[model samples]
Target: MKRKKVQFGVMLHGPGGHMNAWRSADVPSDASTNFEHYLSVTKRAEAAGFSFVFVADGLYINEKSIPHFLSRFEPLTILAALAPMTSRIGLVGTISTSYSEPFTVARQLASIDKMSGGRAGWNVVTSPLEGSADNFSKDKHPEHSLRYDIAEEHLEVVQGLWDSWEDDAFVRDAGNNQYFDKDKMHELNYEGDFFQVKGPLNIDRSNQGQPIIFQAGASKKGSGFAAKHADAVFTNGGTLKQAKDAYKDMKQKAVEAGRNGDDIKIFPVLSPIVGKTREAVRERYKEIQNLVTVEEALAYLGRYFDHHDFSQYDLDAPFPELGDIGKNSFQSTTDEIKRRAKEDDLTLREVALQETTRETPFMGTYEEVAETIITWIDEGAADGFVLTPHVLGELYDDFLNEVIPILVEKGYYDTAYETDTLRGELGLKFKENRYTQKIRV
Candidate 1:
């Protein structure tokens, strides 16, 4: 069978792509806390014919550097405000299964989908950081395996709640003193290992029945959960071969779990710092790098992995042997760095810079950047990409004006959005509930 065409999305945070993105002189530093900044970016994305925009979430700030990382509006609240501003792009917001209740999450997501006319998406995450657990009244984070188990149950309950009120369940008929068709409403009464949720959700079913479910997990258990439930999966593989391998494995896992392999879309995050010329791009990258303080990088790293005392390492010297960082906490990142260094014959300092930043070969002329994305798509490495702009609005503007036309001409991207609803744009058909089994008397 012929492969499907690639889809595209943009991942947005404070001012732009990553935590250090604010350092870019062109990006407004205060945009992280400014609602108008978000609105501006959203308008740009919608006009560009982009598929969606995503906002990530975290529950707590790092104890060591609270000042640097803690100033952004909550994702769901921001997305709710964004719902009415745009007409076509999907609005995805992350919510932690480890900290939120099933019913509450279901209600919030459904409400946003309704408010957006079916353009909401939920990115389910099982946070592994310990600080988040402390905020949730737990002294320690749960084991990774146990957390995945809870996520599985949580997702099932949420889906059940979303389906409780069937389409046409509410008649709003007042003449006959009948407000609803009682038979059309069903009770979930879900009893599971991690949670017990009873009955139908208080809110009505969304226009799309449920919000699109996005998952971002790459570990063994994480990949499994994503294959079984995610409408789309976000991953962070740095090489084409690695992305292809991961995508193939995920599809196989989905098939083994009795799901259609094509049901789950794989999107890898690509942070491209584009410019009109290679020299210009390099100059821009250097400017952004200069603004990153060691303190800020270390603060961001400590939150995601082991708490490294980066202050001790010389800025010009090679990274010291990472002998003390917790194996479970930083193993994947360390392994990736080591592999890339050996394969590319890069120095330790260069490896550190690459892993800590977003500057890459994708940062060149418009033709060069577009060619790189087309190459990746043709390689069967990903269904599409989640573009992470290094500077607020600049990368997006450049892409829309310079690169989108090329993609459209090559028949690799859409010239216009197919529908206002996210589900329709994503090619998801609304199907009748198949979980209900019939009894043969």
Candidate 2:
């Protein structure tokens, strides 16, 4: 049999972009709070034959340190609103296991899936930021290991609740005054390490059974959890080799957990800054760079560096010699910068600019970008990509107009969405996957 074509999605962020994405004058700065902006983007994505539009969630903002768009509408609420506006596009949103109750999360997601006619997806995340704990009324954030532990159990409860309502559970016979079939509804009766969720979900099972589970942690515990549960894994891979290795590792882990390795769709976040020519792309990149301030960059860096003050260092300085500052503090960030700097033969200022810009690895003309994406997919580095636009409307419009047709022509992506439900579009086995295997056995 011939292999199936790859898939793709747009990873939407608040206020039109990520980090310094707003610096693009073409992006709407007010998008974080504006429902109309989200509607416009989702409609465009759907029209472009994109797989889905993903929304990331963060509860609090470090106002003094970073200019993040934190006070926007909640992910679930926003997704629900967008569901009514568009019919076929998937709506995936982040919900942290650290703070939310499984029942609440399960119910809300199920409701959205139903309301949207089964186009909802839940991106499960155990928030890494310690500051989020404060907003949730906790004195301190749990350690990383502990958070994953809770996440494992939290996922079990949520999945169980979703399964509580079987396909035939809702009959709604008006003549008999019967709304549901009691025998088909199963009480979850789940008692786990972190939570005790009892009985069936209040809502009926969604069109896709349970909404697709999206996960994005690359830590050991995270990978393990994703292997066991995630329908799609969102990742950040800087190189084709790195992405391939990560995808291989994730599939191996999934097999060990007794799930089909191919079931886990790997999507790496690709931030592409495209233009008609290389110089035009470079110029556009430079224009965004000019908007970044030293203070803003340092504030963004401070979150990972813990004890260090980036403001004290020269803006154009190379890697600082931190003598025994503890490898735990920003080690990954520092190492990545060092590696990229050497690989690209970049100056310290260039490295700084790259960090602030957070451009997608694939940056060039439409044809070049399309070829690069196809190369990654062919290499088994990704099943698809989660595109993060550097500029909001313009960036998306450019890619949709320029790159999408190329992908469709190359037989790498869909010319049109094949299914209405988000889960169906992603090719996920909605009803008979690993979650139902245990019962079948």
Candidate 3:
């Protein structure tokens, strides 16, 4: 099957994606806060023709929080720092609507878009951790469904602010002493249930117009929001079957929401452990599994369940019974964990270890891993993937030198960038300012 080119984005999870990655002797323990480490890795990814670099974020952390989460660069700040350093690769960073103002979020992203020559993307999210409310000065976290309701309105306001100025508003005619066309400028006097923003945004539009919108909403309400608004959707893509189901469902939802199915791209996270041989791959995986104790695994699992103390239950016994406990925080992920425990009859110890050191389908010899990736794209399971390597230093190098060459040779992936902006590279259209369209109409 002759398929179109597949896109790729790397997740910049310092240290690595594994819970105990920081403990490895090869990985720098302070990689989470080391700017030089990120700079070097980002430059390498850019040279290898990655479409973007994604920075995931969180608002709150506890004693049980992962090492990277305990101390990490603020998403937007790091993206901004990386902007001038890289040329073509998109700079995407997470920002939560639950605890941020629309005007501020809109302006900050627009600044990055302008500075990066239009290579900016915003990953919109609603902070799900209950402790986040404490940080934001609230009595309790918003209910699960209500948070989505707030997110819809919050995103609406941000988009409206982004369209405040038309394309030709700055008609810099110095001789005539005309700095801008007053008639072309528009104000977004938006008043939604959650926010009210009256703005003729201080900053102007970039070449790609507004920054690209990315969302990772896997719950029913969350997925609906993504279908309606996001330029791309991030998913877990648990297996071949699951990935296909998610891709088809998301496309259908986008069509139903009055958008073209191709407008929204699906990118599942793939944390591969690559090696020259199958034995090497097995050894690498075992090294990662041995780094974490069972106690640490249980703690890692707790984060998804709103920090529910898994230690209270019998580790060797069947998984504990808890209904609607994690509904407010990471609902879909928590539900899946519960369902799998029941379905597979896994004990608490088994489930915890499995979640902490889970192996992906993209693990094997270089050629085999390359084939699996190509199969997913050719089979319509994914538009692309977001690589979060299990072993950053070695696996990333292995993928770049080994598997990537195979994908490039087979005509499934490109080794050079085709466009300047994130939207252009992703096959998405440049967003026109709303005011400009109104004037033409």
Highest lDDT scorer: 3
lDDT measured at residue 242 in model 3 versus the true structure, 0 to 100: 94
Q: Which 10 successive residues of model 2 have the least lDDT summed?
A: 324-333
Which clashing pairs does model 2 show? Answer: 271-360
Query: What overall lDDT, based on C-alpha atoms, would model 3 receive against the true structure?
Result: 0.91
Predictions in order: lDDT: 0.76, 0.78, 0.91
Q: Which stretches of candidate 1 lie above 4 Å from their native place?
A: 1-5, 63-68, 312-335, 338-351, 434-441
lDDT of 2 by residue, 263-300 (tens): 89999888788889999999978776677776776666
Return the lDDT, model 1, position 339: 55
lDDT of 3 by residue, 84-184 (tens): 99999999999999999999999999999999999999999998899999998889899989998999999898888888888888999999999999987
Q: Candidate 3: list runs displaced more than 4 Å.
A: none
